[model samples]
Target: MGDPAAQALCAALRDRDWRAARDVLVTVTDPDDQAFCMYAAGRVPDVQEWIGEWADAEPRSTLPLLVRGTHAVHWAWQARGSASASRTREEQFREFHRRLTFAENLLDEVAGRDADDTTARAFLVTAARGRQVGRDEAHRRFAEVVARHPWHRLAHAQMLQYRCAKWFGSDEEMFDFARTAAAKAPAASGLAHLVASAHLEIWLRLRSGEDNRYLQQAEVRAEVRAAADHSVRHPQHGRYAGWPTPHNMFAMAFAVGGDHAAAAEQFRTIGDQVTELPWAYAGNPVRVFRKWRGKVTDSVA
Candidate 1:
């Protein structure tokens, strides 16, 4: 029931067909896979609700439980008001803490029943961050997951965030994890995308004017190029699960680095699917992606 529509959605997403994207996303079944597609399309609420329905229907399925935790963290992040909001910041923090606590409990419940639920363990990293848990605990959760699924893309991405300096990890630690993860993954497994993800995190943290220079740095550009060659651009790159998400990250990195040609190729690979993250740091990801795509298309034309 879900496969044909999900496949069609994947094909349309590969072509960047935005118009029919939503209609197709409704057909997907796998909780994380469906959430990935929905997130790319900016349908966060829909995915959360759909996952909730799945959880209700199949309370035994740990997949929906894990996705629910991710969704809660997303909401909790939103609840944490910005620095400018002094009036409601306290209230926002309360809501944020509540959400994070809920997500952590959900993950803990998942862990209790299924010790092998790596996805739940991976998501625990995010919930822990939101809850202001210590980095050591977050790392422990991440290690528990990666030890099981060494090449788990979602787990690696979550771990990358936990390893970020903003979350108590230093630059050296973040990059080391990125490089190590890439080195350990099988070729064409799309694990190398973590390098580009690390660079994007660094670029986002840099001062406004420093972003361009930071991206163009010898090592930064080298890492990005290596990740591209090893993953999306590899001649034998396979269409692994959640393929377009990494392409979106790579595309954004190249576009920001002034490498329109490389960005265009990644855009071509990702088509219309656009996620909230990495792009959200720059502002409305949909608009940013459209602007970059236009620039890439003009450069090619």
Candidate 2:
């Protein structure tokens, strides 16, 4: 979503040019953009090798710590892989916990020094999930972020993941949270994507035909249309670095739900900018994207 700034930062981090990365990161002023940027950059490989230099270089600044801590969360998950707990090995789980703990410490340091560090606070919500820190702890970390920046798209997204049935909450809990948050966010804010995300999450959990059936339900499809109007489809929707993600999510939601007309509209808006999520939950991201897109377009044609 916030891939542009993250790509620049990733390039700098890859080159081990902390100064260049810092220069690029400082240009982004919005706290949620800052959080989104760091979260995306966290996927860069071997950042742990040289990020400490940035930390040492700017002992007082939380940016380095933010980068390092966010990277650790990604690093932790990489160690764990995307498999279910039963599919994951004991060693992988151990390393996942260790890296998550390391990330938590660094994030905690940032939160300590900068109470307003939403980037740090947001990642802690992620860390809570990795560590399986239970609902209360996850909520506390989420509370920390919204208390500072209410309707923070980044924080809300992470918190929504934490509350998902796959994590700690039930399907009911997840839907309630998504509906409430989407309603609470400004009409133009990308936060309404949470509804799409929740729908996509439930779809992922259901098996095969059941998944498609759930999405195609009249009430479910209706809810998504309302959310789309409230956010991405809204005339006032602000196109930002993360704009494509919601479009992609809704596109998949519609195509799978048999609303080819709606799906075709979103695909036109999306073009080639496919996100890894909702699609990845199905099959090869690009393949899945094109498959559904072709089907929807043909149906509409």
Instruction: Give the winner by TM-score.
Output: 2
Predicted model with the maximum lDDT: 2
Cα lDDT tens digits, model 1, 48-134, are: 444455567667666456556656666676778545445656788899899888777877887888866665676676676667678
Candidate lDDT (C-alpha), each: 0.71, 0.88
What CA RMSD would candidate 2 show? Answer: 1.2
Q: Would you estimate the TM-scores of all the predictions?
A: 0.77, 0.97
Q: Residue pairs in steric clash, candidate 2?
A: none
lDDT of 1 at 65: 66
- Which pairs of residues have clashing backbones in candidate 1? 16-272, 40-274
